[model samples]
Target: MNEDFYIDPDIHQSYTLPASVYTQQQYFDVFKKELFLPSWQWLGGKEWSDSLYTQMPHSFLPGCVDEPLLIVRNQNQLSCLSNVCTHRAKILVESPSAKPFISCGYHGRCFSPDGRFRSMPEFEAAQDFPSSKDDLKNYPLSSWNDFYFTALQPKYDLNTILAPIHQHLSSFPYDSLRPEPNLSKTYHVRANWLAYCDNYLEGFHIPYVHPTLNKAITYEDYEVRVFDHCNVQIARCKPGQKPVPLQKGDPDFGQNIYAYYWFVYPNFMINFYHWGISVNWVLPKTTDETEIRFLTYKRNDIPDSDFADTALDLTEIEDEAVVESVQKGLMSLTYHRGRFSPTREQGVHAFHRFIYTEVFADSENIAP
Candidate 1:
């Protein structure tokens, strides 16, 4: 039987997820399969500079999963396929291009752009040739704007993960948001991926850790909303800070909304300002290390300097220092578990419950 880990539904009775979940290799291995693969992961950017969107071939979860995949756009239809050769397991596509179809560089095995197996050299002599095995395997794909996502085996509905995000910002002109290469940055943190996420899921640290951010947004009004498979923390503007004018009929109308920080389970985050969107994709590279990519997209009216990198970068530095300390402390024999703040840490508790539930879905007995 799988080792069970329980997180109480009642926040008042619950403790944080066990320290082993962050520090142990066994739990990390389990999460890679049961938690991450079943949840949709941020694959790649689909922002094309050309008139036609070309065939995009890239490795899925580059450092970790290392699954070879190709994003094929044929006649405006998009599909994701295994980039491995059917003949001898050679990688099919290595780069992005405007190719009509895929031909394995190793043996010249050919497939249609949408992954339909067309032909292969010298295979005419083979008996019972060209069955379903010859075709490239396709994964279920979903998109939000130019971004793409897919699961190895899906547990949650893609729409359920996305609908809330869209409805919240449905009134905005989404197509106007364009990618800004200069504003995008990547950083490696010497901490568990979940630790970084846990720190982000709550605003409890803003007052003490992020003084500038604390001044920009009122600490008393900050709110975190937990959804089915995601959560969002809303920040209201402080006295001198400018609030993104909330439209009438909107859920947050009459409030001074500063930023809409949304966390889509496991790793991806979409932080929306009136100026643009800051997308954070946290990738688990190892049990104790994670790589975070900060991709920014904004409307033309929003100046490059308006993105607030100063506050963002400074806040990140402070956050890293704290979470890194927590990472080191997790290794201590005395630090087994911690408690959650009922009012301020419901999001963190929600995340723990999710991890426990996903990891123990097939367990013979639940943990006490």
Candidate 2:
């Protein structure tokens, strides 16, 4: 398996990723280190006020990456850091606290709000004991609206990677959106994470599977816009439904654009609706299991029909059924590869190309 492989760059001339990606444990275990860890992913849709620091302790893609992360807030600045103490490998910040200081529970070591080492007990006699290495390891952190993102070794600047999101939503008043914990949800799906992502990257199944969402959206006018490291699917509202009106100079000005289903590279999804946003994170648990989290942020008052829990549940149920079935079908030796609709599946194709380039490229160039 050390030999390098390739994913055909041209979608028109390419086959889908091997079925083993969704069915075999060897592939998952191998890719877990080189690919998933360094890639940018949504950490449980954890939203924090960029203006204020909120202690947010989250596991990165819990089951698959399972990296314990700490989001620290000191005064007005925010940062993400390794939750493990470097001194003795002890977990730090077991829970969120309002204090403006951090202390390692294992020893008397202390760090400032920004993760810089401040003080240590009984180290006066130690030669050069306190250094930058003793500081809490910090991760790169950034935000778009209420969404916060972090990566240990991001391949590119997150601002550059998500430029599409910022450009498309530049004119919107999404700043009004506030985190609503009561509305967030999590679901365990009996399917591989990639299988779940595959289903999410297309809308061809909406009419067949999601009757409620189908009624809310017009299938004819929907469009998919592909970008580097991300993709956007336009969901125009059906008759009688309202959209947060677009302003002049906005990309979709003068259109009843109900939502923008934005899928960032890998497993993060930001579904923007008039009422608010439904942020989805696909967390891989095992070869055939995944945990999907839906964290909601509301901008203002929402009508029951536009953003109701029951409506969301119905859509999820339909999607889960289809993705789970696909997972089962991939187990068949008779089915190994399939083609994509050149028009409808560009997003899925783009996602596959990204997965291949990052996971299977000359791994010698990858960081250890």
Which candidate gets the maximum TM-score versus the true structure? 1
Per-residue lDDT tens digits of candidate 1, residues 236-288? 88776666545666688787788999999888888888777788989888889
lDDT of 1: 0.80
> What's model 1's TM-score?
0.93
**TM-scores, all models, native as reference:** 0.93, 0.91
RMSD vs true structure, all candidates = 2.4, 3.2
Off by over 4 Å in 1: 1-4, 45-53, 361-368
**Predicted structure with the largest lDDT when compared to the true one:** 1
Give the per-residue lDDT of model 2 (tens digit) for 1-368. Answer: 22223456677766787687788887777667766777777643334553333566777777787788888876656788888887888887887777677778888788887888888888889898788898888888776665667787787777887899878878776766777788889999999999999889998888999988899889987899988879999989888878855788878888888789999877888887787788888888899999998888777655545665577778888899999999999999798787777778888888887877777675653333
lDDT of 2: 0.79
Q: 187, model 2: CA deviation in Å? A: 0.7
The segments of candidate 2 whose C-alpha lies over 4 angstroms from its true place after superposition are: 1-10, 43-47, 50-54, 301-306, 363-368
